[model samples]
Target: MRLAALQEDEYALLESDCLFHLRLFEAAAMPVVEPVLQRCLVHSQRFKILNTEPDSRVLLETANRHVAIVDAVKSGDAAALETALSHHISTIVDFGPDVLPLNAKS
Candidate 1:
């Protein structure tokens, strides 16, 4: 996605999800979510802080990437957004059982 193709509504919806995921889990999706995140840290200068502690950096980076994804979504690039979303879903499915909370009422 070029970021210009996404409709306003689509961008808004994806942006919301990205923000929510960042708030809840620190990362929107794994592996696929990494690049977007790295870009943000590099752009935001948080990457330097991350280098001081790899483990902590990873956690923070994940959250940063979620924000980046939202930015990308807002960019309105349909292809990029679609790719990001696809990877996000894949990451969720892969880690779903471990990370997802079971229904307490069950």
Candidate 2:
């Protein structure tokens, strides 16, 4: 359809990707952050080219934190998971609201 519609669909898909990764962490043993982390890595490059070097570094650190979180989850280390999650949220906040998609309620 329209470009806006396409972007909406893309945003929804990415949100679903995060949700699926959370579900996997909740119900299974596998760490499903790979897909989301890979996307964030690409976003870092995009942010850098867009002259948002700070946000790009934040995104890269967030991706690295995801790897650590995944390892903590796989090892069943709840304390590590909590700390990692906190750092991850802080990194995203530093990345700022404009860098992320704001999907409207459907």
Candidate 3:
């Protein structure tokens, strides 16, 4: 994942990103929710790659976030893990292209 990010290969980076999340769902052993996550991931893939190639800084930060998640998990730091997860989620939401702000007038 870090390698993909440093290389600036968005497709590979995206693959790693998806794999990381999917693995989380798999590890959780949530049979029903896993499929729902899959569908959501498909949209995630579209929103990511279908937009302009992401900035390299975003890719690097993403890689760092993944590492932080793993570190928290390995250390059994639930609070840290939640923080990392929240950061990752917020980063994705904020950086997403074609995603309109809720307060924007229609």
Two-way lDDT contest, 2 vs 3, winner = 3
TM-score of each: 0.33, 0.37, 0.76
Q: Tell me the tens digit of each residue's lDDT in model 3 across 11-73.
A: 898798899999988987999899998999889878767765577887787678788889988
The sequence of per-residue lDDT tens digits that candidate 1 reaches over residues 1-106 is 1231132233343344444645433544477776676555344344333343334333343444455457666897878877776665565322235554677535
Clashes of 2: 0
Candidate 3: stretches off by over 4 Å? 95-106
lDDT of each: 0.48, 0.53, 0.83
Model 2: lDDT to the true structure: 0.53
TM-score of 1: 0.33
Please identify model 2 stretches exceeding 4 Å from their true place.
1-21, 24-62, 95-106
Clashes of each: 6, 0, 0
* Higher-lDDT candidate of 1 and 2: 2
Q: State, as a TM-score between 0 and 1, how close model 2 is to the true structure.
A: 0.37
